[model samples]
Target: MTAMEANTDEGVIDAHHHVWDLSVRDQEWITGPEVAPLRRDFLLADLKPEARASGVTATVLVQTIDIPEETPEFLAVAADSDLVAGVVGWTDLTSPDVTRALAALRERPGGEYLVGIRHQVQGESDPRWLVRPDVLRGLAAVAEAGLVYDLVVRPHQLAAAHEAARLLPRLTFVLDHAGKPPIASGELRPWADAVRLLASLPNTVCKLSGMVTEADRDRWSVEDLRPYADTVLDAFGPRRLMFGSDWPVCRLAATYAEVIDAARELTAALQPAERREVFTRTALRTYGMTFTGSQAPQEAPCA
Candidate 1:
C-alpha cells in the first residue's frame, strides 16, 4: 500500500531542516546561482506556517555552518519557537576543549533544546576525517554529553562513517541524506553497499531526505528517488529511518511541501505504524525529544 497522503492531522517530527539569517553570518555555502533562491533569510516565521500546514508538529533545526556561535543562536531559536523541538548545532569536534564548549552551550538560555552536533564532513577532503584521533576523542565527548552526532558526508566518506560508528559504539551517528546517494546518476552499487554497511551498525540511523536535490532536480520525480529510498528502508527499516525536509537547501530543487509529498510517496508501501516510526517515533527516539501540551496529538515515550 502507498503511504497515507500528506495530512496536517498526522503528527510529524521533521528530523532534519535548517533556518538561517544572512544578516547574522554569510552562509558562504549559499554561493552560486543554482542556490540563489536560498540567498535570503529563512527564519522561523517563514518556516512555521509552511511546516505547520504540512503536518510538521515538531522539527529538528540542523546547523548550516561549522561556526561555534551558530549552535547557541539555534538553541535560542528553538527556545522561542513552538514548532522547533530540537537543535542540532555544530562545534569544533577536533578541539581539546570540545567538552567545555558543549557545556557552555548547555548553560545558555535555550540550551536544553540542543539535541545533537553536526559538521560538514562532506566538504572535508580527508575521507578518514571521522576516524582521526582528535575527531574521535571529540566524538567521545559528544557521546558523554548524551548528544547524537550527525554525519553530513558524501558517498566516499561512508566507510569512515561506518568505522567511526564502530569505534565509538556509544555515539548515535545519524547519516544525513542517506550518505547522499548518486540518485541523479541512478548508480547505487557503492552507495547502496555503504549505506547497508552503516545501517548494519545498531548505533546508526539514516535520514530520508535531500534526494530531490541529489537527483535531476529540474525533472526529478518519486520514481527517480525510489531505489535509494528503498535501500535505506530495507537496511534501516522504518524504526531507524526518519524524515527530514533538508529545507531551504531543498528549495533549490522543490518546494517544502513537494519534498514532504515526495517522501510520503516514497514510503507509501509501509504500514501505518511503520510510517509513524519514520515520521515521528524515530526522530523523537534518536533525538531524545518530548512534546508538551498539544504540540503532538499523541506523544511517544522518550527514549
Candidate 2:
C-alpha cells in the first residue's frame, strides 16, 4: 500500500523501531541461533518500505545493546533519513564521565536526532535495578541533558523502574513496550497494577508498541494485547500514550501493516482528532521533535 492508502488517517508517527548491522557492531545480546534471523543489517532504506506501507512517516530508532558508540553512529545515520525523527541510544549510565559522554553524543554528526537515552536494565540481575548509585547518577545526567530516559525492563524489574522515577522526580521516563508485560500466560494484575503505579507519576509516559511480540508470539491476536494497552491508555490517557511499531522486532510477530491495523482496530472508538494524538502529538512532545515545517498528513486513499 502507498503512504496515503496505508493510513486510515494522516499524521501517524511510529515512535519505536530498531536498526542494526552486525558487521559494523556487535549486538552480542542477540544470542542463540533462534534470534539469528534478526542478526543481519537493517538500515533506514530497509525500514522505509515497511514504514511507508503502514503510514509511519516518523520513527524513533531505539538502542538494541549497551554500546556507547552506537548512539553517535545512529545520529549520523538518522541525519540522512527523513523518516527517522529521533533516536533513543545507549550510554554507560554508571560511567564516571557520564555527563561528558552525553555532551559528546549531543555534539556528534547526527546528535540533533538524539532525543533520549536508554540502558539495558532488563538484562541486569538486580531486581532493584535503578537504585544503584551509579545508575541513579546516570539517570540524573539524562535529565540534565534534557533527554527522555527510555526504560527497557521486564515485569520483575518494574518495581525498580518505579523507584527510579520516585528517586529522580524531575526526570522524564518513557516506558518501552508497556513494561514488557507477560501476555503469553494472560497474567495481568501485577503487571497492570505496576503500570498504573508508574503512570500515577506525572513524569512518566508509556509506549503502546511491541505488545504483539510480548504475547504468545506466533499465536497473538490484537485482542491479546488489549488489556496491557488499555491499562496504559487508561492510566496515561491519549496525551501521555504514544504509538510505536517496534519494527524489525515487530516483524517477529506481525508485519508492520498488520501491527498498525491491529492497534487501529483496538483504538477504533477514539475520534480522528484523539487518534491523531496517539499516533503523532504525544510522541512529538515526549521526544522533543518538531515537525512544524514537514508535510501535513494526507487524506486516506479513495476506495
- Candidate 1 TM-score to native: 0.94
CA deviation > 4 Å runs, candidate 1: 1-9, 293-303
lDDT, candidate 1, residue 52? Answer: 79
lDDT string, candidate 2, 1-303, tens digits: 111112223578888889888789777867786566677777788889888876677788898888777888888877777677788998899898989999998888877778899888888999987999988998999999999999989988888899889889889999998899888889997988899999989999989888988888778987888887778889988888888888888887888888888878767777676677788877878888755444655422211
* Local lDDT at 218 for model 1: 93
Model 1: ten consecutive residues of lowest lDDT: 1-10
The whole-model C-alpha lDDT of candidate 2 against the native structure comes to 0.81
Error of 2 at 103 (Å): 0.6
- Candidates in order have lDDT scores of 0.86, 0.81
